[model samples]
Target: MSGGLVALLDDIATLAKVTASSIDDVAANAVKASSKAVGVVIDDTAVTPQYVSGLSPSRELPIIGKIARGSLINKLFIILPIALLLTWLAPHFLPFLLVVGGAYLCFEGGEKVLEKLGWLPGHHEDHEEAGATSAEELEKSIVSSATRTDLILSAEIMLVSMAGLSNEHGVMRVAVLIGVAFFMTFFVYGLVALLVKADDVGLRLARGALEPEDNRPGPVDNIGRTIVRVMPHVFSVIGVVGTVAMLWVGGHLVIANLAEVGVPVFHHVLEAAEHAVSGAGGFVTWLVETLLSGVFGVILGAVIAWLVVGASALVRRVRARA
Candidate 1:
């Protein structure tokens, strides 16, 4: 009996060690994968706020919450299993899917640019249009739009995570993919919630400072007001940054994908430029490559958008006559 008990104890200790190692592996891989997807994450953060832009203060948080929930569902319930299957069954298909995702990012970025430049109609005019709607309707609209956007961003994130995983057992792959899905959904939506509520927080602080008890104008009030005043500009900056991020990330993905598929011209050009600059010109080289990539992405995006838009219009005309 004593000998048997000793053997069991030793077995339990070995199992514990195995479990601990598995946990560590999952964490390390999740972190690495999340970092690889940072560009897409930045664009996700930048793009999300626009969905809540026209919403009233009271509806903002709730709408963000709804979208966050949807994003969670998307990652865990939808994207994870699909990602694992693709990784296991059809790894070669990933680059093609990523290229499709890149095209989508380009299309979205190009559309935003066209809207800002007054070339696209239906630019969101919040005060006039959204003001007429009920708060509940507005919230639903915002949440739906946000969730749709999240689906695409979530797809990109999943693909990045899938690419980062080692060719391990199916169970290990599933564990890492699910772990990353949860981490990214929480990270992205939590940040979005904070950003959406920042203006309200500023307003509350301003009101508190302006209370009659304080009497004289205080620095707090001034700062609060300043935040309120600058919030729109902040959102504008985020919009521009998001568009630029989309283009940059999309272009980078395309370049990387092309290199993966055996075309190395762009990669070689970038490397030669980096070498020519040597130590002193590193930053300049990076900037030039990034700018060129962005320009290429934008041109490709615009052409695609034009084709899509024109095709849709023709279809609509045919339908109308029919």
Candidate 2:
């Protein structure tokens, strides 16, 4: 009886050690897979702030919270199950779906560019003015639009993350994916909440909310004022970065997946470009690749935009006739 009890205890110890090792492996794999999806992650971070840009300051964080919650649902309830099912049942279809998602990014990015260039019908300034007609309605609208966009972006993030662990154990893959999804939603939304409220924070500090009222002109005031002055410029920069990131990510996704599907022309062109610039260092090579990708994305996006816009217009006319 004593010998049997000793063996049982030893077996339990070994099982605990194995479980710990598996957890560590899942953590390491999750980090590695997340790095692979950095492009979409950055795009997600950059694109999110625009939804809350014109809203009232008080509602910004609440709006971000709602979007973040929706993002969690998207990743966990929607994308995860579908991705795992597809991986099990039809793994080969992922690249095609990625292409579709990439085209969406391109279309969004391209539409922004066209709108900015005055090629599209609406004036953004005017639109913003009209869009704010009702704060509640605007909040709901922004949240809805942002959530819809998050669905596509979240899909890409999960797919890219899973692609990194394609050869891993099934349990490990699912564990890592869940970790990445939760980490991304928290990090992206946390950063966005910060960015959206930066000006408010700066304003409070500029007024010396923490300092004694007698300290009329402290160094903190200067810091806060500078932040206030710089925030608009920062927002403008974020807008440009977000739009370009969308195009670059979208374009790269399409190009990379096309190559994966055996249509390697675009990928080969990018590779040749990289080779031509081999002596210029990795940064230069990357810049060249990005520019090419953006160009391709713009072209593809423009075509999609025309089709989408024209189809909408036609639908409107048909409705009007009825």
Candidate 3:
């Protein structure tokens, strides 16, 4: 009886240890997965403020809050189940979906690049000036528009985050995804709220406008002026950063997955480039890899964009003739 009790106790202890280890693995995997999707997260953060921009100050938080809730619904309820189902039913299709997502990201990034160069028409900025004649009208417009955008961006985020977790057990995979979904929605929207309010915070710190109180700049007062002065530039930088991140992440995803799917020319070339740069140390090698990926991404994106544009034009002509 004593030996049986000891064995039972040992089994219980072993079970406890396994449970603890599994929890830690889930957390570590969650963080790693989230890191992989940082590009989408950054773009999502940058894009969200436009929904609240130039709106009534009082309506901003409520608008952001509702959009955030919609985003959570998108990730937790909509995207999560669909992703799990795919993983279960047709695990083989994930790389293709990721390639599609990556291409979308690259095309978006390339659009920004081409738009900046005056080579492409932009429908993106036109979204901001849409009519919002009343608070209710504004809320509906912002919520619906932002949530729709969030769904696309959130889908990319969840899938990209889970891409590296294919080898994990099913329960671990689900837990990591759930953790990532919650954390990312919160992080993206939370930062967006802070960003939109940055100007307001700065103004209060300035104690007035961009200038300090009574022409005397205290540390806090100077900070206020700095933030107000810097916000426009900050927004511009964020747009650039988001674009670059998209290109890098998208390009890397495409290259890596192509290798996975038995087309490894680009991947081998990238590896060779990295090997060439290895003597410069780790950071330089990483930079070279990222730049090459971005370049490849832009080229692929431009080709896709051209095909899409051509197809659209052909369809329009056919419709007109019909």
- By TM-score, how accurate is candidate 3? 0.88
- Over 4 Å off in model 1, which ranges? 1-18, 54-56, 125-138, 166-169, 211-214, 262-265, 278-288
lDDT of 1 by residue, 1-322 (tens): 9999999999999999999999999988887888777767887887777777755677777777788899988888888767667766987777777777777778878877776777766445343345437766666666676787788889888886676674656777778878888889889889878878888888887888875875875789888788888888877777778788788877777777777777778778767766777677768878877887788678878888778889989999999999
The residue-level lDDT of candidate 1 at 192 comes to 79
RMSD of each: 3.5, 3.7, 3.2
Residue 21's lDDT within candidate 1 is 99
User: Candidate 2, overall lDDT?
Assistant: 0.85
Worst lDDT run of 10 residues, candidate 3, spans 208-217
- Model 3: per-residue lDDT, tens digit, 59-142? 888889999999999999999999889878998888888888999999888888987887877665444335866668767877
Write down the TM-score for model 1: 0.83
Which regions in candidate 3 have their CA more than 4 angstroms from the true location? 1-20, 125-133, 208-219
What does the lDDT read for residue 4 in candidate 1?
100
TM-score of each: 0.83, 0.83, 0.88
Q: Pick the candidate with the highest TM-score.
A: 3
* Candidate 2 lDDT over residue span 187-306, tens digit each: 899988887788888888898644575757578887888888998888788777878877887899899989988899999999999999999998999999999999999989988987
Which has the better TM-score: candidate 2, or candidate 3? 3
Which is the better candidate, 1 or 3, if ranked by TM-score?
Answer: 3
